[model samples]
Target: MKKALRWISKNLIKIYAFLGFTYLFIPIIYTFVFSFNKYVRSNLVWKSFTLENWKNPCKPIDICSALGNSIKIGLLATAGATLLGTLIAFALARYAFKGRGFVNTLIFLPMATPELVLGASLLTMFLNLGFNPGFWTIVIAHVMFCISFVVVTVKARIASLDPRLEQAAMDLYANEHETFRRVTLPLVAPGIAGGALLAFSLSFDDFIITNFNSGTTMTFPLYVYTHEKGGLPAQANVIGFSMFFLALLIVIAGQIVGRKRKVSA
Candidate 1:
């Protein structure tokens, strides 16, 4: 008993990590496994394995279109949120301006607020403004909530930046614009990229806000939710697994590129 207890104590952390990862990945593994299921209508039960689902991921009606809409909204929202948030982050980090504290507080409101409340409020605002709920509305709603996360991410990066680098550039006779373009932008690029990626993921995964604002237009999440009464199609699982793999590949590629840069530097 003593030997067993000691062994367990020594390996507790490893065991915990293994269990944690297993718990997190179980659903993802299930999704990947079910993607190969040969189901006529419902993918609830695994009948037989087949490659047809992956071969024709877009075979299901409107699934690909829904994915395309999500991609479009994610891109637009990420672009808008990253641009605005990066500027806000820089301003907050670099300058002391009137009402800066107020602005900073406001930035956190959307993030702190519940998605249901935020979505409903946005819906009300859009209706009051005589705007129709559709693709642009979804994009706008995503950007609004995603900005807080982007600002928080980029602002931390901006705060960590060494002012001495900028000072050194100035000492070397580099003008303000030139220094910013050459040195500051490069230093800040990683943070901006991280923020953009985060924003895109959040926008793509969003369902509540999209549902509240999207009247007729359908996104991937909405499609999945709407079809839940009917067993989820194998195509949905295929798309989900493909997206997961694509995201994993992107993260791996980014890590490789970052390591190369560090080694070269």
Candidate 2:
């Protein structure tokens, strides 16, 4: 009876997994399908299909501009956050420091808070300091959320590192800076790269914080939200489907590179 019940539980977990996957993917599939729709309604029927939306000509000019800004903000924020987070992680994971717990807690607090609350609080603080919520504000807000992820990822990487390398380097009369550059860094570089890529992905996809701090800024996600609220647009589906294709391509490219590396090894 116990074995039978265990078997039933395993089958039930598989069923639940399928249901969850379906729930997640159905909307994305629908969005991709309707990207080619002739009509812009929320629902897509068999009769509607067109490529005009994807191959569109534009006059409003905001989409292109917003795309540029989003890329800019993502790159800048990712770069800044990755650099700062890596430094902090190295310090924390390599050395015993005063107020380490307090500092770590403070560092992680932004990530734990709701995006809406973070955005609102930052907006208020920036406004109080006579800075407006706009492009740079959005970048800063993105950095706040993104940095914690980097710190956590890189800290784990550093924590897992062999301290013997540093000890050996010191025995060879290498300075702390030299040891860090030569020994500590190369070992953790892959993890840091992975973390930064992840941070870029998160910053790029963010909508809630972007929306609150954007002011006049129109990121792709914000653009989608705006058009979605106004009424559905064929162009929205086209953008979404494009993102899906881009994500798929990235996944495939990573797999190919990974396989090639394995073959090389």
Candidate 3:
């Protein structure tokens, strides 16, 4: 008993990490496994395995349309948020302006506020402005929340940037625009990319805010939630798993590129 206790104590952190990873990945594993299940209506129970679901992920009713809407909104929101947030980050990092602290505090409000509250507030604001909820509304709502995260991410990167690099560029006869376009932008590109990716993911995965503003329009999350009683289609699982794998591949590729850059440098 004492030996077992001692061994467990020594290996506690490893055991905890293993369990944590297992818990996090269990849903992903379940989704992947169920993606291959042969089901006519409900995919709750495991049937014979088949690759048809993978072959036709869009076979399910309206799933593809919903996915397309999500993709469109994600892209638009990511673009808007990343552009605006990167500017804000640069401004906050580089300049001292009136009410800068107030602006900085406001940026965190959306992130700190609960989704339910934020969504409701947005809905109310839209209604007051005589605007109808739909695709644009969803995109607007997503961009609003996503901007906070993007700003936080890019700001951290800006804060970490070395001033000497820009100074050196200026010393070499590079003008402000030339230095920013050539050196500053490239140095900050990774953070901007990271922020854009994060914003896209958040917009895609969002349900509460989308639901509040979606009106008759449906997104993937909405479709999944609405179909929960009838059991989600195998195609849904296939699409879900495919997205997960795609994101995983992108991360792996990014890591490889980073390693190569490091070696070359």
The numbered model that scores best in TM-score is: 1
Model 1 alpha-carbon miss at residue 31, Å: 0.4
Residue 166 CA displacement from its true place in model 2, Å? 4.9
What TM-scores do the predictions have?
A: 0.95, 0.83, 0.92
Positional deviation of residue 75's Cα in model 1 after best superposition, in angstroms:
0.6
After superposition, the stretches of candidate 2 with alpha carbons farther than 4 Å from their true spots are: 1-19, 40-47, 57-61, 164-178, 262-265
TM-score, ranked from best to worst? 1, 3, 2
- Alpha-carbon runs more than 4 Å astray in model 3: 1-12
Instruction: Give the clash count for model 2.
Output: 0
| Model 2 lDDT-worst window of ten | 57-66
**Quality of model 3 by C-alpha lDDT:** 0.93
Query: lDDT of each structure?
Result: 0.94, 0.82, 0.93
Residue-wise lDDT of candidate 1 within 131-160, one digit each (tens)? 999999999999999999999999988889
lDDT of 3 by residue, 46-106 (tens): 9899999988888878999999999999999999999999999999999989998799899
The better-scoring model by TM-score among 1 and 2 is 1
TM-score: model 2 vs. ground truth: 0.83
Per-residue lDDT, model 2, residue 166, is 88
TM-score of 1: 0.95
Which pairs of residues have clashing backbones in candidate 2? none
